[model samples]
Target: MTRISQTTRLEKVEHIVGSGSGLLDFAVKGENGYDTWEGNEDADWTVEDVDSVQNVEEDRYIMYPEGDYFICEIEADTEERNSGPVRCWCE
Candidate 1:
């Protein structure tokens, strides 16, 4: 039997916002945090990949109307104020 190897990179990641409808594509962000990776104003603030309401501290994420997802690092963690760069919200 012959074995073939393929490169593993840029997998599609879906970060579900408050609801499970909104998806976040890590392709534009480079997978997970291993590779650090945009943006809107007056847009709604949302969280993705949250395990549970009690576990909101981890897996912090935010999505835009244009389906752009990003890592939202809020200073207070109580507000949607981001302290880091976000995903691309292209319209």
Candidate 2:
């Protein structure tokens, strides 16, 4: 007699960067149910996350299929370089 069943799926992410429009975005929910946007980083702000896009990182970036929480930020609009959209919170 043999019986085996193993299934695992966990995805909860939260990341933010938008104050001065540096660029870095993430917002994933558990069991796949939430999402956010702003990904793509660093247009040359002394290398804040400007590694030519694609998982850019300096302060925070590249968050997918992970686990963690407790991140809050506010300043959704500063006006400069694609100005706007910068608000975050993770729980």
For residues 1-91, write the lDDT of model 1, one tens digit per residue: 1111121222233332322222222323443433222122432434444433322334544333324443343121212222223332222
Question: Could you estimate the TM-score for every candidate?
Answer: 0.19, 0.27
| Candidate 2 structure quality by residue, lDDT tens digits, 27-79 | 44442323223322443222122222234544544432222542423232222
Give me the displacement of residue 20 in model 1, in angstroms: 17
Error of 2 at 30 (Å): 4.9
**Model 1 lDDT, full chain set:** 0.30
Error of 1 at 19 (Å): 14
Worst 10 residues of 2 by lDDT: 1-10
In model 1, the runs with Cα more than 4 Å from the true position are 1-11, 14-37, 44-55, 58-91
